[model samples]
Target: MSAAYVEHRPISSSKDTLTDHHVVIVNGASVGGEFSTQLAAKNYACKEGYHPVHVARERHLQNRDIPDHWRKDPC
Candidate 1:
């Protein structure tokens, strides 16, 4: 089974618009899974086991943030 893991870290000492970074982990690994929002990171990690399906659907919905390589087609 896979699970979502989140790590919080300050981006810098200065007061910035985006102060923190959220890294999403699953099965002790992270691959391009970083988000400005914790909810997005958690949602990314939660789809670990079903990445292809999620990517496909998200792509269909015109979610441009999703990487092209992660899509289900052309496999």
Candidate 2:
């Protein structure tokens, strides 16, 4: 061990199954993020959907006064 100690984390929802699958979701809403997070916790890959209209609505508060150039991807 050096000056800094390292730690290891066991992945959650370890699985022996190899039946790959995809989950199609609605726009990137809170529920969408939650679903993806849970599936990843269970060892599944995820694909999230995003619509410009939905994103604009969702990020209205965060982008209230910030200039477009300085903001990060609204997704």
Candidate 3:
């Protein structure tokens, strides 16, 4: 696959992450993966390249330590 470009507005702090209040969530999917879904499921917004499968996995990883509602649940 060709290189994929992800874009986002300037983030000022970790508070901007969709996964955690302490993490920095950047919008955009992996060139061949699912970083976007992982971020979006937690209410994170991205500009492009969103894969549901990938996002679901990211949500799972992000939720390993938090309560059910505290993290993104698998769809």
Among these predicted structures, which one has the highest lDDT? 1
Q: Residue 36 in model 2: shift from native, Å?
A: 17
Error of 3 at 28 (Å): 14
In model 2, which regions exceed 4 Å deviation?
Answer: 1-12, 27-49, 52-75
Best by TM-score: 1
Answer with 1 or 2, whichever has the higher lDDT: 1
lDDT of model 2, residue 75: 30
Clashing pairs in 3: 17-25, 37-55, 38-55
Model 3 sits at a Cα RMSD from the real structure of: 10.1
RMSD of 1: 11.1
lDDT of 1 by residue, 1-75 (tens): 543345444424344434356665445555555677655655665555423222222211222244552333211
Which digits, one per residue and each the tens of the lDDT, describe model 2 over residues 17-45?
33232221232212322322223422211
Whole-model lDDT per candidate: 0.43, 0.23, 0.30
RMSD of 2: 17.2
Cα lDDT over the full model 1: 0.43
| TM-score of decoy 1 | 0.42
